[model samples]
Target: MREVRNKWVFKKVKVDVFRVVRRVEELMRELNDDMSVAGEQEVCSEGGGRWLRPEVGWVKLNVDAGVKEGWGLGIGAVCRDSEGAMLWGMTEHRCATLEPSMAEAEAILVYMNKARRRGCSRIVVESDCKVLIDALQLKTKGRSDFYLLLDDIYSICNDFEIVL
Candidate 1:
């Protein structure tokens, strides 16, 4: 029969290997959890909030009017990391002629155009302006002065991703 000490040493070696394997397994499980979370990108806005989940990775923008009615349009956009924390936030008032609908559209156009310039290829545009959203979605024709400005805003969609 094999010496008792030899048998005890062999058992110890097997136990050590098993412990190492278990540790590796635990580490791998944690790594998987982190990776899945890191893969997501979230964007929250006034209308609602959006998340990339997995397949979708995009910048999201939200626009709203400012306190001053005739001062111009106030636009707010925030870019977020995978964890729903804002990476960047911007709010601006444009120096354009003011009509509520046109101002809203212009704000969105500025936000989208800025995102495009920053090399954002995928984006989700959000606005509280239902009329503008409807107009863009409907692809309406003809023009009033307001419509002409809206048309210019619509034209901006061609340059980048706009989620209305």
Candidate 2:
């Protein structure tokens, strides 16, 4: 990571007509820094999950995992600062059935990507699923379909620190 004047600088490129995802990540990091430095209103916080605060202004992202037998799956995430204020959040519902681990992973990916777009950099993600956390920690390979999702997650990881 290249740091210029205490700000991370990233090259932005346009692919065809659409922009790559990392640009959003960079902007999100900037937004988070500005909000924290300016002491903006609270957006969200770690409700009741494990979190690791490695930096003074780093944001905490809390995600919850839910599974439905026939209906599919649902995941919710709330991004907050150390002050316990909400910054941004999302609740995703996937119609396709998925394993608990996959659901958890997808949820984190979703939340992380969203946070990146919002300019969040120093982030600690909190989730309720221990299995998912362990898998991410162990860096295990998943199924083929899951592999693609994991790839996206891995690509964005360069933008933020993920906490289990």
- Backbone clash total, candidate 1: 1
Q: For residues 66-148, write the lDDT of model 2, one tens digit per residue.
A: 77677678788978777554677677778978888778888989889889999988888777778767666677676777677
Span of 10 residues, lowest total lDDT, candidate 2: 1-10
RMSD of each predicted structure = 20.9, 14.1
lDDT of each: 0.60, 0.68
lDDT per residue, candidate 1, 1-164, as tens digits?
A: 12332453455333354765577467545534654666544333223544342124665565555434444445667554334434455777565557677667767777677777778766666666888888878877666876786777778778765566
| RMSD of candidate 1 to true structure, Å | 20.9
Candidate 1, pairs of clashing residues? 125-163
Which residue segments of model 1 deviate by more than 4 Å? Answer: 1-55, 67-72, 81-83, 94-97
Q: Supply every candidate's count of residue pairs whose N, Cα or C atoms clash at under 3 angstroms.
A: 1, 14
Give the winner by lDDT: 2
Residue 156 of model 1, lDDT score: 78
Model 2 alpha-carbon drift over 4 Å, by segment = 1-54, 142-144
